[model samples]
Target: MSGYFVTKGSKFKGRPLTTLPVVLNQDLSRIINSNLQLKSSHDLEHLRSVAQQTDEWTKLTVRIREAAEASQSEH
Candidate 1:
């Protein structure tokens, strides 16, 4: 069995192994391309707005902590 890397730069067997030719999902290429596409100003502004909003940040932190606790409990 072989493990896949979330990143392309991952190496294996002391070689620069990146993508696996077989068992490759076609959607994986699309996903990479979509991620590579530059984000628009609207997206940046939205992220900035979320960061600027203290209430939102606090809510997000609380939610993240809740998720962490839930995952730990599931283990």
Candidate 2:
């Protein structure tokens, strides 16, 4: 009935546009904290490490993509 809804009979419903960014950011923070063991999102050393280590960068990118895909599929 509302603008957020796809249709009365639709199986998938629309979510607030702002939700994706919030979810993605939370996912990013979780990955950085738990996987990368970084204290701050702005850690320069982590950035340097990612830049220097191809494997680390690849892993990070894969995790981010997975998280984004999962979030999108949910909506």
Candidate 3:
């Protein structure tokens, strides 16, 4: 239920690019201590590399909720 997401490279429309979706999971420090080398092959890749300490992740969660509400209102 809790994991990270890595997206793939973009698609082409004419001369522009589009977004793609891909997911990958690396070994967490709680799981492994070795350094990881990831290849660049995506237009967008999101990672939850660091563990949230206190209210750090909370701010992001709140911002996301606010954005969602704003989007809903725009519709």
For candidate 3, the lDDT comes to 0.35
Model 2 misplaced regions, further than 4 Å: 1-27, 30-42
Give lDDT per model, in order. Answer: 0.44, 0.57, 0.35
lDDT (10s digit) by residue, model 3, range 1-75 = 122123436653685322222212221111233232223422113223322434644654454456556667989
Question: In candidate 3, what residue range of length 10 has the lowest lDDT sum?
Answer: 21-30
TM-score, candidate 2, is 0.47
Candidate No. with top TM-score: 2
lDDT of 1: 0.44
lDDT of 2 by residue, 8-38 (tens): 4746457644554344446666453455433
Lowest-sum lDDT 10-residue window in model 1? 29-38
Query: What TM-score does prediction 3 earn?
Result: 0.36
Give the Cα error of residue 67 in candidate 1, in Å.
0.6
Candidate 1, residues 1-75: lDDT per residue as tens digits? 123323448355675444432212222223322221113444434545765999976765565466556667989
